[model samples]
Structure formats: structure tokens, C-alpha cells
Target chain A: MTYFAGIDVGSLSTEAVIIDEDATMLGYSIQETGADPVRAATEALREALSLVGVSREQLHHVVATGYGRINIPFADRKITEISCHAMGAHHLFPDTGTVIDIGGQDSKVIRINAEGRVLDFTMNDKCAAGTGRFLEVMAGTFGVPVQELGELSLKAQKEIPISSVCTVFAESEVISLIAQNRPREQIIRGLHRAVVSRVWGMAQSVGIEGAVTMSGGVAKNRGIVALFEENLGHSIHIHSEPQIIGALGAALLARGEIHQK
Target chain B: MHITRKEYLLEQKEKGRRLMGVFPALYPREILWALDIVPAEIWDPPLEIRQAGAHLQPYICSVVRLGLELILQGKCDFLDGFLFPHTCDSIQNLASVIYDFIGARKPCYFFYHPKIPHGHTARDYYLKNLKALAAELKRQFGPLKMDSLREKVDMGRRISELLGELYDLRAARRLDASNEAFYRTIRKGEYLFPDDYIAELEGFLTQTRSEESRNGATIILSGILPNPPQILTLLDDLDVQVGHDDLLNGSRRLLISNEKPGDPFEYMAECYFHMPPCPTRGSSISDRMRHLLSLINATGAKGVIFNVVKFCEPEWFDVPNLQEELKKRGVPSLVLDTELNQGLSGQMKTRLEAFIEIVRVHRESITTKH
Candidate 1:
């Protein structure tokens, strides 16, 4: 009955997961990060704890991950989402070699080995063009829920190109297309194409190795996934709850610490 | 110990020594040292940048902004003049803005090193440039005596060799000094007189070797210059030893051992060309990659931390390509964009911690594998 908890407080959303000593996932929670990271993280942790009928005091350890990992006061450890994503993806897909994590703040391509150790990695250098934030900003302009961008884009008949690599410039391009009375579906397709293109450049930079796995909330975008797979020239393994993989990884790490002790 | 660097310069000036503000990259400090002129190397002045933002474009690097700010605020009025070496467009623009636009009282000295060596005249042209600078110094200060020039050249060589030894000791993981102590001790040359600076370095070398474990994660920092203090402190806090650096301020100048057997100008020219390939010098990406990898292997460094200056076009052009090369070689690196004197941000601390954790994990995994 010894349970471990992990929480990931990302810029756009927060997620928490719980696991038992046996490494079996017990429960998880996902919610918008909101303005207050502490509140968002605590609420998500409480929800995950409640799902397993466990109180906060019952947890053996609590590990935090993601951009706001350092802000989590109750956590026993703070692990980078880069490391957590690699760990989480490898946990679900043990054959994973390369893990592409496109998150709200930054995008990273990490090369993991057969044993789930990161070989080498690179992150988008202080630029927002190739990240989840880019899409979120685009979604706001389109008056669409960020989650529906993938599904909505899949309906495009003829995709137009969105050429700007910069987010602000691309937003202007999106506006011009909107003025030109272009179909929403086609524009969404172009936007997805742009995100995938940018992320693909990062993936190529790290170079593909073994079976690729996708992590972070962007993995929820079915259209972006399709584009990534198309450019990556292979199938990708994504967890059922893609957004919570980092949390799951953190929980697993927490369990490992317990066993060591 | 308590006097500010500026105060030290004023003291030297009051003693009738000429003080010149030297800008970034590839200046023959020996020339000034020979002339009894204290070249106050101005990379990053620890002044609050209030008015610099109004004049400089937001896209310009902080080095240019702060350097220009130091002059614009009239803090550098004590300086006899400023020497702008051919470094980057930002620095070149700053020179023009100060000389051509501001029309400041003190004369500005410019040394244009040929970007590409074309023929036999390349060395001659460089020698001419060096002699022209000397001639300019004579017109302003006095005649350059050969004996004083040779003595200062000797001093410069001694200092370079001492620094080179320090670098070697650190690379071998035998240096007892902390990261801050090591860099701060080396950078004392920025303001300290050669005799005093060399004495301090000599003092440091007495405790050079130690039986300390080299097992901690070692990294090479590549950048234009090191500053803001906190990053060095953080590296030490993380138990990460900076084994060696390819920084403009660090090994770039000290890399060429001062063993050039020739006249002063030729020796200086040799040192200039032999500086470990800088992108500002128009070195190809491949050359930079080779030099970086060599440092990595030599130091047993686990990774490289590219502490690039923000908006530095010269460094930026080479970083992505160099990073790609590192990735291809399966070497890990973290690229950071930093401004001068802007202390480490909270997010930056987390990132540094994560990078260190990654190195830790990678090390543990390696040992476990064996």
C-alpha cells in the first residue's frame, strides 16, 4: 500500500500521477496550470491522491517535474521534464531511443539509450516558434480550444502553407488568411504543419534513433503526431495519457528512491 | 583589496601612468604594458544599465550596450582613450557611434586585423597595423623604447605561461582552487598591474595540485566572456568543476603558449593568429567544433556549457552548428543566452540543476554498465 506521487506543473497545464510500490499506476489528474502554480499543483495532487483513496500523509514520496518543478514545496525531488520525459517514455515504451517533448515553454529532443539513459539532447534556444505555446497562441486567435486543434485540422481538404518561422509573424499570416476567407480547417492544417515542421527540425538536430516516442501535451494533437510520423518516416509510440507521462516518470523515480532506501 | 577597479585605475593615473580602455578580442596587451599604459580591459563594467537602453537597439548584445553605456554616462572620462579591436559588428558599430557620432573628447584607436590572410603581405599588413598603432601611441603618449617593449613582452610571456599552467593543472583535475577563485584570480588581469597580477597567480599556484576527486561532472564553458558571478557560484554549488574554458577572456588569449621566438611584433602576431578559433575571427564552424571536441576529450569533460551572450551575432552564428556537431558526436551540451551583470534567473537555476542531474545520471549509468 506504499504509494508514491509525482506532479508536473507545466506552463499551460498541470498533471499528477500516483503509483504503488509495485510500479503499477494507481491514479492520475490533469488540469490547466492557471495563474498560481502552487494551487494548481496542490489541487492536482489532491485529486490524484483522492482517486486512490489515499491521504497526502500516506505517500512515501512526492517528486515534481516540468517548468515549475522548483516551485513545488511538498515535493521530495524536482526532476527536469527532459529527464522525466525520457524516463516516462522509456517506462511505457521500453524500446524507445529518441523522445521528442514539445512543451509549453520549450521543445527538446532527447536521445535515450537501450537502458533509458539520455545519450545527448538539445532544446529550442529561447525561441517560441517550435513549442506548445505557439499552438496555444494560435488557438486563441482562431477561437478554438487548444485541444481541438488536432481534430479540427484533420478535416482539411487542401492544406495551405504557413511559411513564417516566427510566432508573431505567423499570427499575422494566420490573420491575413482569415481575412482572405480561407477555410478554418485548411488554416488549422497549415498551422499543424508549421508546428510539426519546427519540431521536426529539432528532431533531426538530435537525430532519430531506434523507435521514437512522443511526450508532453503536444502528443495529444493527433494531426501534429501524424505530421511528425510522416516527417520522422516511422511510427511513434505515445502513452495513452501523453500529458501525464512526465508525472508518471517522476512517480516511478520516487518509487526507485524508496526501494534504494 | 577593498578599492574599486575604477579607483585602482585612478590611482595608477594619478601616479602619471596612462590609462586606456581596451574593448573586446585580440589586442596586444604587451604593447600597452610596454608603454607603461594600463589598458583597462572593459568587457563588462558592473554599473547599472539605466540609459544604455535608450541609445542602443534592443537587439544589440549587452556587452556593446554596457560598454557604450559606460562611456555615454561619462564614467570613462578619466580614460585617456578607447581601443576598439576588430571583433564583431556590434563592437564596430559602438566604435563608430562613439567616435563619429558622439564626437567625444578623447581620441578613439582602431586596429583592423585582416579577416582573411591573402598573401605574403598578410603578415606584413598585420605588422604595419601593429606599427601604426604604436606610432599613434607615440604621438599621444611618447616614444616606444625597445628595452621597455622587450621587458613587457617578457612579462606578458611569463603571465601567459603561468595562466597556461593553471589551465593545464585544472584540465588534469589537480587544481585545488574553487571555480570562483580560479576565474576571479585569472581575470584579475582585467585591472591588476602585471607584476601584482602575476604575484597573485604565483600565490595561487603554490597550492595548485590537490588529491581531490575529479569524479564530479566536468564541463568546458565556451563564450565571449564570463560574468554576472552567480553562474560560476552555481557551477561550484552543483559540484560541477569547470575543467577548461574556450571563453574570449579565458583560454582564447592564453591558448598560444608564449614561446614564440621572434621580435615583439611577430610574436604578438603569432599569438593573435594562434588564438583558438573564434567565430568572430571568421573561423569556420568545423574548426570551432574540432577545437571544442579536443578540449572536451583533453579535460575528460562530461559536457560543454555554451554561455553565449545574448544578441551576439558572431557567437550565435557558430553555436547552432557547433551544437549540431556535438550531438552528432554524441556529446551533451547546454546553450545559454546571458547578458552581462544580470544575475542568474530562477528558471536558469532549475535548468542548471537539471543539466547537472543529467550528467550525474549519465555518469552513474556508465559506471553501472561496467
Candidate 2:
């Protein structure tokens, strides 16, 4: 069977997805992005191929996405992460009019039209305070694995206040809290709340619409997701492994490109 | 040698130099240096606009409006070329408007340097941008030899290093230099004679003396485009020594080095990617605040003055977060709403006097406790 491959080379990770003509996922792989994104993408593609037991020669088309998309020399086409994310999120939820993606280093609130095309978007790629890196640093400060932060935050009995919108100052505030005998769970929850507030501010600035879907690595943080829901006063739908959405969209685009040819 | 704008214009006329005007940071000075052209920085025009009108919205930003006013008033008639970067949406569109409507005869180029101060992804993105910019410059200016380019890079780096040293002196409150002189030095270095701007600066530095005792409350200014004479003059008149400024015309223009050899294009890429970025250019607001605080601490600054140009969306987005962060860090900050023609000296003096009094009282109380 003919298959199309999509690769997404993000700041913190790389993802590869394979899909058939019908846009059904055949295989997928996600891995940490090392110093070199090109190598990471190649490795991710290999892993995806191994999972599906399909030879590379079987792939009829290839497309690349994410910040390093243009660096993938072998890709047949390269598309922007903004466009790819909107396409992937829309594919999963037809009514997802907005996509709020908090990645490793940037936060983007994309407003999409009914047809899944980007209408207007606001991106905060210059600050880490509203991104996953902020949570990762906070997690390290609490001496817990980054992945467990979401679960630990759910146990907080009180909402500790973190007024600093900067990641460095907020980290210091967290340390001060630790000194003040504050619980780690409460601090984590406060951290998530701070990120949610910042992201929500951006979403509000660009006019957030109904049926928003959260994508990118930060979407996996249930604590942040919950806080975002509470802050926005609306529920959010999440994809299975939202980080791969960019790659999935690219693969779908690749399939479309092949059909056009 | 110091020259007034009129004198500089006359000198350009005598020398038969094609005068060009550029905005800060992305003027492609190396190319101008090679082409033997006199590039000038458009800081602020003298004309007063009764109304910027509907074509230029109130939310369009003061810097762009000032530039637009300059073009509209025919103040920039002598300019043969104009180079502006995509620093913000207002400025980006301003460049296009000036090129198409006002300065239609002059060649205009807009450098697109996306925000890359947040993550590794951004760093790589900036690197790629540097490569693209180098290719574009080469295309426009024709083939540039490695040796000549290296020499130009070296000259640029040397000038930047001197500017950095001057800033260090200001931070120490050693130079009781007027704001006009400081702004002139930055304008001349970054826009006019970027490669050979050091001789004039060194001459100024030698003649200047440090203040015997620190006067008033020291504050660091943070923003994208600070009009040289207007902002600095206000601070100077208020006896507030601008300890350091992270503006495009200040430290941001001086942060990059050109020591790398072999491929000049590669060196250009390295320099552009590693340079301290302006807020409007996609740098993280948190990182900028942190850097400003560190500079303030080093300079013994009592507070920060965030003078954001009116209607500049990016700086507007950044200022609130920065102010909150500074306050959380125990740093007092004041936000000044700026317009191109607004005479801020009176309001600034009042604010500085009060701020200095507070700093003095706080310091005295700490001493008493000790």
C-alpha cells in the first residue's frame, strides 16, 4: 500500500507520522530533538517506519513541518507549523475554530475560519514564561519529573499566588515559597495558573472562538489544560499525542500533493 | 569632529556622497561602508503634525508616525535610499508606504529578522535568517570579496566595542555627557559611519569627565526605538543619568562581535544571531527585563524607565509583563507614554525628582539599620 510521510522538527522534539491516502495514521514516532534537527527527523522517520514494518521505498510523498521544516533536505514540501497545526486540529475536531498551542519555547493562539484556514493569529515566541520550558524549570525546582507535574498539581489544596510573569522571577518566587513552607503541589498549581493566565491573555487579545483545541507538547500537561479551561471559562478538546499534530498535517498535505501530481 | 545636521548635509554635498537614511540595527552598514555612501539615521523630524489623519491610525505607533511625518514634510528629500527592518507591524507597513508613496524615487529595503530569543528553535531560525540576509545583501550589492568583507566586519566590531565601553562609562555615571551627545554618538555610529564612527566617539570620550558624585536617581531605559535627542535630553535635563539603555540605538547595536574569519557571510550570520535583540524584533519580554535588571544592578541604578512609543503593539504587549516582573524583583519602574512631539522634560523631571527622593530615603534607612 502507498503511504505518505510527514516530519516535524520542533525546538524540543521531533515527530514523524505516516498515513495512507485516506489520511488514516499507519504509524508514528516521537523523539527528543538533540543539537541537530535534521538527524532527529531522520531518526523519527526510521522509528515510524519500523513500527509500521513498511520500507522507506513504499512512501510515495514526504512533507516537513515545524520550525526546522525547511532544513529537511529530503522532504518534497515544507509548510509552516501554524498552517499545519490548524489543519491537524481541524481534522480531529471539525468545529475547532481556534487552536492554542503552547510548545517548548513559544505560545501561539491561532484563529481559524470554518474551513480550517488561518484567519488571524498571535504568537509569543520570544518568552518562555508561557511555554513548556517554564513548567519544566518549575518541575526541576520541585525535584519531580516534568511529566508528573500535572498529576501532582491536581492534589493542591490551595491556589498559591505567583505574580511574576517572568520565568526567572517566578522560579525565584517558587523558591521563596519553598522557604515559606509552601507545598510543592500548590506551587506547581500556581505555576500552571500563571502560564494559563499568560496564554489566556494572548487568546483574548486575538479574540478566542468556540471549540478551541490545545496542541503542542504543553497540551499533555493536564494541570495546565485544566487551568486553561477554568481561565477561559470553556472546555478544550485535546488530540491523542497533540505534539504529532504538525507532522500528521504535513503527511496529509503530502498525500494531497501526490494526488495533485 | 562634531557636526550639526546642516553642516553634515553641506559636507555630504561637497564630498558628492549619496546621502541615505536608515533606521536602527538593520541598516546594512557594511554595504554602505563598501559603497562609499553617507548613511544618516532619521531620529525625529522638527515638524509638528496637527493630525496624523486616517491614513496613519493612532494605533500605528509614534516612531512610524514620526518617520511618516518626515517623509510627508519632504524632510527626507536628500535621501537616495532607505533601509528599515520589520521591527513591528506599524514600522513594517510604514516602510512600504514610504517606499510606494513618499520616497518613491529612493530604493527601499526591509530586512525581515523574525523573533528568535526564546528557544533553541528560535536560535536556529535566526541563524537561517542571517544566511538569507547575507545572500540578499550580496545580491543587491554585487559580489563581495572575503578579504574586504572581513576588514569591514573588523571595523564594525571595533566601533561596536568602543560604543560598548562608552555605555559602560555611562553605567558608572563617569561621563556627565549630555543626552544629545550620547544620542548623536549612537546615531552616528549605528546609522552614519558605522565602520569609522569610533574616531568621533573616542574624541568625545577623551573630552568628557565623570561626575564627581552620582546625582539624582539612576535609571535604565528599555524599549525598541528611543529617539536619540528627545529621550536622552529629557533624562539629562532631569539630572537622571541614563545608566544604560537596551534600545536598538544603544547596547543592542553594540552586542555583536566580528572576530570570526574565513567566511564573512558566516561571521555576519553568527553576529546577527547572537546579537542582543530588541523587543519589537521578537525577543522575549522576560529575557529583556532580566537583562535590563542585571544592567541596572551593575550600574547601581535605582529604577527602570520603560518609555514605550505610543501604539507600538509589541512593546505594549511587553511593558505590562515587564513592569510586573521588575516589581516582583524589588525594582521600581515607571512607564512613560511617549509621542514623537510630546515635550516630556517637565513631566520627566517631576517623576525623576520623586524617584530619586525615594531611593535616597530607602538607602538611608538601610544604612541606619546596618
Candidate 3:
């Protein structure tokens, strides 16, 4: 009963997943990456092993992904989240041909083929305009938890426009809106719209193909998906647990690598 | 292939060669060569900026700031004079600061290359500027000999032909060298005299296919000089091969011609106009797009990386449009804003890794489909 494992050490969080020979999920774990990716990656791998009631020696292969993929010294191989996300999304939705992944620090739009390989992709990584960090900054102004901004936006009515896409300028705009006694929900909605607008430009550049799927932590935010779907003029498919997609993809890829051996 | 700048200058001086500091972009080095002057091209001077900030606008590029800083610190005092070729607004400003404002101790010369595409009178206009620059050199140094200029022009043509051969080999994927070594080899043209540069290039090209071909996504790195050098080390680390380049301070500034069939002055003018479309020269966006796409097709690159220097207005002006055009053609590209002499950021590294992943996946996707 050989099992493959994957550890994804991201900027904001680290995740780990395990899959059996049949490609069935066993268990997974998620933890804050904090300031050190190496330690967080180890902890994530341990969590995955412990949750599945197995030792590190039980894993047939290990694949690492995310920003800290190279930092995981013990991993057998490292892969990029761009391919991981596409592979993960396609596994969940076989018909999915496009993936829109918005993470803590960047946004990426990937075009995937039926074989779960990446056809093309674009990213906005140089600036924090259309990233999760942008919304986190806005959430700080409203004194709301980053995890709760999605629910708050659902209650938005009389939605106001947040013009600036720059995080600094958008933060000031949010602060000024708060100062004006504007509704917090409306500001949250506007921030979501700003992010959607920025990410939409990249999505259009890649030219959407078949059914679109959304991945990454941002996909967990219903408000962002709803706004992005509206702009895309189609409903987006999201995994039941979207945040673990990259790790799941890595585990899947690890399985393939082992079989080839 | 190997000579220290100090050693090269000493060797040249022993041969009665005087040196002049030349700023970035188009300049007729042949004129200086005819006068027994070695134009030491200055693109990105890796030095701490202590005094240039007070003189330059905050929005000016680091390339300009560093070049100006080198002069302000008198680090370039060993040179006989300076030549400023109007490359961009930032360079134009730097020229004013050094030549017209700070009032350099040595003689100063300027060349205003035509910004727009060639017109009916463009050739004559370029020749006039060349003669004017020659007149200036005649005052500072000895008079330029017409016969010597013709020989220098032939020297320039040979250099261009050799560079073109190197490029064509790179495009055909026959040159077997790492991206860093290739660029470093090409950039040696900046300091080496024509005699040494041609011999060294010929030798380097002969040894290119000895190693195994790089196993990674092919990329075109377009922008300013591949400064910070760490980017190349990182490319080596990531296994990404730079198959071709549109680097303004590097291959983009190379004379892309082998034609010296007749008049030397007219041949020089033809080489200038025959240059591959560049953003700084105010060439049409579509023209640059066509050139880049052809390079991609020629080199089989999976993606294009625009390594734009921050505050480089000429590049920034043309990037978005060029990116849009490339996108329409289904070509993936990345824009990286960099500062010279600075280390690559962690975020930048992640982005680049992600991009390589994209290219790799894309290649797999295409291959799987076929």
C-alpha cells in the first residue's frame, strides 16, 4: 500500500496532501508558513503523515510545490504552483480548460488542455494590485478578519466604486471611505470588484477556452468568485476545498513520477 | 576571449590609442577608431550612487544615474572625453547634466540619432550629424583621415557580420553555451578593440557546440543590459536558457549589417537604419512585434521576458502594446522591472519559477496535442 505525498510551502501558508496508489486522498494538513518556509514545510509533511497514520518511510515519493518548493531540502522533487494548480483543477473538473488562481501575493490565469497540461498562463506578480494581499490590506481598514471579508461582501448594498488598484492607494481610499461613514460592506464589495477587474485583464489576455475553474485561497472567497464569474460571463467551477489544490496536484504528479520508475 | 579592461586600455595606449567614455545607444565608433581613439562604451556602471541623485530626477533610470555617478565621482577621469548619444529622455537629461550643466573637465561630444523611422532626407541628415561629430573629434583629437575612416567602417562591418553569425547560430539552436556566457561574450564588444573583439568572437563561436544543449524552456530576454549578473546565475540555476535577446544595451545596439559595398558614410547610415526595430529609437510597435515574433519563431522560444529597467520610459512606453500584440498571437510573455546592481528579489524569483513552469507545461501541452 504505497502512498505519495506533497508539501506546498506558500508565502502565507503551507499545505500537505497524501494520495494512495489508487489516487484516492488519504489525509492532508494546512499550517501558517510564518517567516520560515523550511520549518513550515517539515511541519506540513509531518501533519500529513500523522493524519494518515503513517511514517515518512511509508511514502513512495514526495513532491514539493509553491514559492518555497526549492527550500524543502528533503523533498524528492519540486514543481511550480502554476502547473500544480492546473493539474489539480483538471483532476477535479475534467472539462475545465482555464484556471484563475489568485494567491496571497500574486494572480495567475492559466490555460489548460484536456490532458491536464498547461497550455498558456499570465501573471501579475510585480505589483500587489490584484492579489490576496490587496484585500487583506482593505480588510485591516475595516477591522475585519481576512478570513471573514467574503461574508461581509455578501451583505454589500449600494456598492460604491473603489477606483485605485494599487494596494497603497486602495488602502487610503478604503480609509477615506471609512472616514466618510460609508458602509463597510459596500467598501468590501468595491475592493472585491477592484481585484476582479485587475485579474480579469489577465484572464482575457490568456483568452478563455473551455469551462473555467478557480483555485487558490482566493477561490474560497465566494464574493471574488461571484464577481469574477460575472465579468467572465460564466459560472466558475471550484473544488470543495480549493486551498489544497496545489498540494493535491503535487501529490498527483508525485504518483505519476513514481509509476514511471 | 579574455582581457581585463585596464590591460586592454594599457595595450591600446601603448599603441598610441586615446580613450573616450561613450554613453548608451547608437554612436559611430568608427569615427573615433579612425582617429586612434577607443570609445569605451558605458551602459551600466555598477557603483554606489552618492552624488548623482541631487542632479538627476527621481524618475530617471538607474542606467543613467550610474553613468552620471561614475563621471560625478571622477572615476572616468582616465578617459580623454565623453560622448552622449541621445537614447531616451533620461539619457537626454543625463547629457544635459554632464555636458551642459556640470561642465566636464575634458572635451564633450554629442550625437543625436534620428528618433523617427527613416524619411527621404533621413540618410543625408544622419550623414550631416556624423560629419558634425567628426568635426568635434577633429578639434579635441587629431583630424580624422578619410582613408582611415573607410578602413574603420570595414572593421565595423566585419564585427557586425560576426555578431549576426553568432545570433543566427543561436536562433538555429546550434550554439551550445549558457545564456550568461553568450551575453558576456557579446558584451565584450563594449570594451575590446575591433581587432581583439573579432578574433575573440571567432574563437568563442568555434567552441560553442562542445557542451550538451541546455534542457529548459527557451526565452527571449529583452530590455537593458543583463546587469546584476545574478539574474543570469539564477537562470543557470533554474535551467532556463536565454535563446535570444532584444537587450538595448547589448545585442540590440549591435550593428546588424554586413554591407560596406560603396561609400563608408552611406554604409554607416544604412547600418543605422537597418538595425532591428528598437523601442528607444521610437520604432513602430508593430515593427518591434514582428521582429520579436520572428525571433521567437527562429529560436523556438516558449516565452518572452521583458527585463525592463525601472524608469526606462522608452521600454515602458512600448511594452504594454508589444505585450498586447504578442498575446493576440498566443505567445506568453513576462515583464520584469529591474534595477541594476541590485539583487533579484524573492518575489521576482518565485514569479520567474512560476513562469518557467508555465512554459514547460505549455510545451508539454503542445507536444501532447500533436
TM-score of chain A of 2: 0.96
> Cα deviation in Å at residue A224, candidate 1?
2.8
Candidate 3 error regions (>4 Å): A137-141, A160-165, A169-182, A259-261, B1-16, B116-120, B209-217, B256-262, B285-290, B324-330, B362-370
The window of 10 residues in a row where model 1 chain A has the poorest summed lDDT is A117-126
**DockQ, each predicted model:** 0.34, 0.01, 0.45
The full ranking of all candidates by DockQ, starting with the best, is: 3, 1, 2
Model 1 residue B105 distance off true place after TM-score fit, in angstroms: 2.2
- Backbone clash pairs for candidate 1 read none
Segments in model 2 whose C-alpha atoms lie over 4 Å from true places = A1-261, B13-16, B50-54, B101-103, B118-143, B209-216, B225-234, B258-261, B345-349
Interface RMS deviation of candidate 1: 2.6
Candidate 1, residue A155: lDDT = 86
In model 1, the fraction of reference contacts reproduced equals: 0.35
Instruction: Write candidate 1's Cα lDDT for A1-261 as tens digits.
Output: 789998999988999999999988989999899899999999999998898899988899999988788789999988777778778888899999999888887777888887676776767755688788899999999999999999998888779899985889999999999999999999989989988877777777668889989888899899999888888777899888888888998998888878988
- Backbone clash pairs for candidate 2 read A126-B284, B174-B210
For all candidates listed, what's the TM-score of chain B alone?
0.95, 0.86, 0.96
